[model samples]
Target: MIETRILTADDWRTWRELRLAALTEAPDAFGARLADWQGDGDREERWRARLAIPGSHNITAVLDGRPAGMVSGVPGPRGDTAELISLWVGPEARGRGVGDHLIQEVERWALRCGVGVLRLAVAPGNTHAGALYRRHGFAATDEPGDEMASGEREIIMVKYLTAEDRTARDVTAGDLSGGCAPPADSAGCAPRADPVPGG
Candidate 1:
């Protein structure tokens, strides 16, 4: 089973490991690189500060008591807006429902915090992630911004948390539109797809 929990300082080591893994494994998907983090004296401090910030929610997915994935979001410039960031799932956990679970957790957290909008930036070449966001009802927006990595363009996607989404007491990942289909060998979960633009 997959479970989601808020990240804390106690999980600093796990967070660091996963962060470095993301940077190293998918440099073009994120702004920071492992070279940029290597030898940084304040790395731990930076992580601490990030977790300590107000209006920020960092979550990790645990599969069988081990960290399988992570996702994070923080308040945006506008009220009722939150920016999704640093989403990743370990290789061993891919093709499962971990990614969807993480996203649902983020949505649940955002709704509980009274945030109405959730936005995320995807690297133009990341068609897989773009598809996932599009399935979640996140429409591409014209908001231009710096690319997460050099030489790559960023596409902004937004998901509006309507009143129904907030009031629906037991909303699960299936209720949303965009997310990777679960693996065929897994439980008898039906797989579906929606064509996403620019993917």
Candidate 2:
């Protein structure tokens, strides 16, 4: 059976291991390089700091007692939006609905937090990953975001979810408008890893 759970500050060891694995296996998927974080005495500190974010939640998936995937979400500056950051699924677990499962958990977490919108960034050339997002209710936005350090152009996608008038399919992956980072006075989605992370 596959299992998934939200991460807390105490999950630092697992977080550090999985994050490093993600960076090592899919270097281009993240803005931060594995080398940048590896071997640092403060890596543990970084993991704790990230977990300490009050508005953030991290989900980790396990299959047969091994880590399979992870996804993180943090509240948008607007308080009504949530951004999915740093998603990654291990190679052996790709086709088992792990990605969908991870996203669903984020949705549940977002709804409870009163998030009205959900957003993520996709690297320009990954068609398969883009299709997956579209299937789940994410649509492309022409949002202007800084080019990732990997030289990949990013396309922002959004889903809108509200407590009322939400549909089964719609609620699965829902709402967004024109992208281009929220306005000067607005809070935009935070830096996310790759579009699919490593999907």
Candidate 3:
């Protein structure tokens, strides 16, 4: 069973755990490095501040009682947009619907915040991640996105929330009451994807 929990600064420890695992397992997927959050840099206050980003929603997916994935949504500089960030799924939970659930949660939140567009950035050469975003209605744009530490530009994808999309979401709002449910088999779920470090 997979479940998602809305996280606050108080749940920084859980966020920290999943974050470290993400950076360690997929160093190429994010702009930030594991060392950036390790050693003396791994302080309690730092993790707390990360989760406390103003106007941001942080979520962690729990699979059978263990932390499985993490993602965040922060209102963009423009009032009408929100950017998805920090998306990662543990190997044990990959292809189990955790990634889809995390993304959907952010989409629902963006709708509530009245944002017309939801955006995200992907590392270049990450074809699987791009496909996953495309499946969720995000399209790559020619616009430049955040620059990574490696001097590469991230791929920007946007999903414009139309009136029809809003109405469909409204009709299914009740489905948000429970945790995300994975298919009976791994093959039934789409492969999970990674996002740029901060978006």
Taking all chains together, each candidate's TM-score versus the true structure is 0.81, 0.79, 0.84
Candidate 2 positional error at 29, Å: 1.5
Worst 10 residues of 1 by lDDT: 190-199
Report lDDT per candidate. 0.68, 0.69, 0.77
lDDT over C-alpha atoms for residue 128 of model 2: 65
- Residue 85, model 3: Cα distance from true site in angstroms: 0.1
User: Global CA lDDT of candidate 3, please?
Assistant: 0.77
* Candidate number achieving the greatest lDDT relative to the actual structure: 3
- Best by TM-score, which number? 3
**Clashing residue pairs for model 2:** 122-195, 143-179, 143-180, 144-180, 159-174, 159-175, 160-174, 160-175
Candidate 1 lDDT tens digits, 91-178? 8888898888888787876665566889888888878788888888889988885655476568889999998987874644433311
Worst 10 residues of 3 by lDDT: 182-191
Q: For candidate 2, lDDT tens digit of each residue in 75-140?
A: 665667778777888889888988888887777666655567988877777666677788879988
